[model samples]
Target chain A: IAGITQAPTSQILAAGRRMTLRCTQDMRHNAMYWYRQDLGLGLRLIHYSNTAGTTGKGEVPDGYSVSRANTDDFPLTLASAVPSQTSVYFCASSDSLRGDTEAFFGQGTRLTVV
Target chain B: SQQGEEDPQALSIQEGENATMNCSYKTSINNLQWYRQNSGRGLVHLILIRSNEREKHSGRLRVTLDTSKKSSSLLITASRAADTASYFCATDNFRGGGADGLTFGKGTHLIIQP
Candidate 1:
């Protein structure tokens, strides 16, 4: 139970609206990531933070933003919601950026844009 | 862009049989990892293999990594209905100076008929 926790298991938003998905980890991990899972696209990384105060973009970063203000929280925000952005979002954390580290994931947030 | 690609997007097998999934990547990786996700749930870490490691085993799961060929495989022996899920292969690549994140491939959906 001492892993990642994501808020709002599911949400429905209107087009052009803004939404923020919350993620927190109790493991004190140094690396955190945000990914969106779609039917045929699999999991695509949106943003990542190697540590607190540092953030980097992943494969698909457009229209999404993330902030790693602290070690325990990494929040992903969508500036303007769109139908194409509707997908399940997951949060993951690892001990470090080392190659051998294993990542832990959250239950995921299912967001639907209408 | 997606760095890793999984083969045989979907597979069906009978219970107690074995299941195998393959993944290939486009770049040099520091490590490769396998994860499983049950329907409407979070992803669970199955195993991790470093660039220098050839194979690793954990319980009923086996993972093989061939860095030279930039491919990896996961084999599940004596599979059960519980083994039915989406399996994904992720790569931790050496991105040269910026913070690194895992690049995931489209997962393989395994169905174990009971």
Candidate 2:
């Protein structure tokens, strides 16, 4: 089974354009997260949802928004993409919010905003 | 600034040599986890060490947590060429009845040369 699937493995978006990164997991996880991976900056959390219908801003959520309509889907949207937004986006999920529980990640989405 | 920082941004060693990566964080955490990422791919969880625990092992991986020093280390024994990848340390600050709290380090790129 595909534990997690992310759409549009790679994307090139122009500055000021709107873009959405879609993530879905079949594990029926209770917690999901969106993080951006940048060189020398590590993975910065953009948004997270502990469960369906609840969302919280992460460390770098200024230009991103996320919605969790169901248990399987959590999408990250950039209202206006910018050059600085170019980075690899990863979607991860965990069975629960337990401290010792591990997270499963999907193949990242490589987005380049020019 | 990111909460976690990994030392030796890049590491290279012979295939039979052991590789060690260190991670330091700024705040109290529920647990510290190690993850590996291949080039142009997503991250895979390697191991997790709780704040209350001192050490853990999985296969060839040996992870040590020193909460008093706010640091952790991962050791890979008998490294192989296939062990070449970027390794990251993530800190979870989750507390009961709250949103998930996590942060990641810039990661150490380890290269196991044949």
Candidate 3:
């Protein structure tokens, strides 16, 4: 099983454009997350889903949106891309919300907003 | 913006030596996790330690958590060239199901010398 798959391994977008990053996991994990990693900065959560049909905002949710339409899919969308939005995005999933639950991550999508 | 902070932004160690990285968080957490990331890739889960546990080990990797001090340490023994990567510590916020995302640290860049 492909644990987690992120589409368009890398992309280049112009400023003020709209872009969607796709993420899918075969594990059917209950929780899914979207995070962006910037140079010299930690991976900051952009949005998350506790389960299918439920979505929530994380620390840095501004300028981004997410939807958990089904157990296998959780996509992140950028409304108006800017240089600040240029970063590597990762999708992760976990079995449960309990303590010490291990998270599995995707390969990542490198987006360059010019 | 960032929940965890890692010490020694960069480290250089001989191939057979050990590498230790420390992380500190400001809030109470259910679990602390360590992840590894190559230069421009998704972070891979390494290990996790619960608040009630002081130490845990996996193969050549050892992790220690001190809830009283809200900190954790990750030790990798007998490092190899393949171990050259950035290490990050992530935390599960105490606020239950809503905090579905994991907050990560800036990360420690470990370089293994051949």
Error of 3 at B82 (Å): 1.2
TM-score of chain B of 1: 0.95
Query: What CAPRI-style quality would you assign to candidate 3?
Result: medium
Worst 10 residues of 3 chain A by lDDT: A94-103
The superposed Cα distance between candidate 1 and the true structure at residue B45, in angstroms, equals 0.4
- The TM-score values for the models, in the order shown, are 0.96, 0.97, 0.96
lDDT for predicted candidate 2 compared with the true structure: 0.92
TM-score leader? 2
Interface RMSD, every prediction, one decimal place = 1.5, 1.5, 1.5
lDDT tens string, model 3, B3-96? 8999989999999999999999999998899999887777788998888899999999999999989999999999999999999999987576
- RMSD values, in order shown: 1.3, 1.1, 1.2
The residue pairs found clashing in candidate 2 are: none
Model 3 lDDT per residue over A11-91, tens place: 999999999999999997889999888888888888889888999888889999999889999999999998999999999
**Model 2 agreement with the true structure over A1-114: per-residue lDDT tens digits:** 999899899999999999999999999999999999898898999999999999998989999999999999999999999999999999999976444688899999999999
The candidate, 1 or 3, that scores higher on lDDT is 1
TM-score on 0 to 1 scale for chain A of candidate 1: 0.96
| True interface contacts reproduced, per candidate | 0.80, 0.74, 0.81
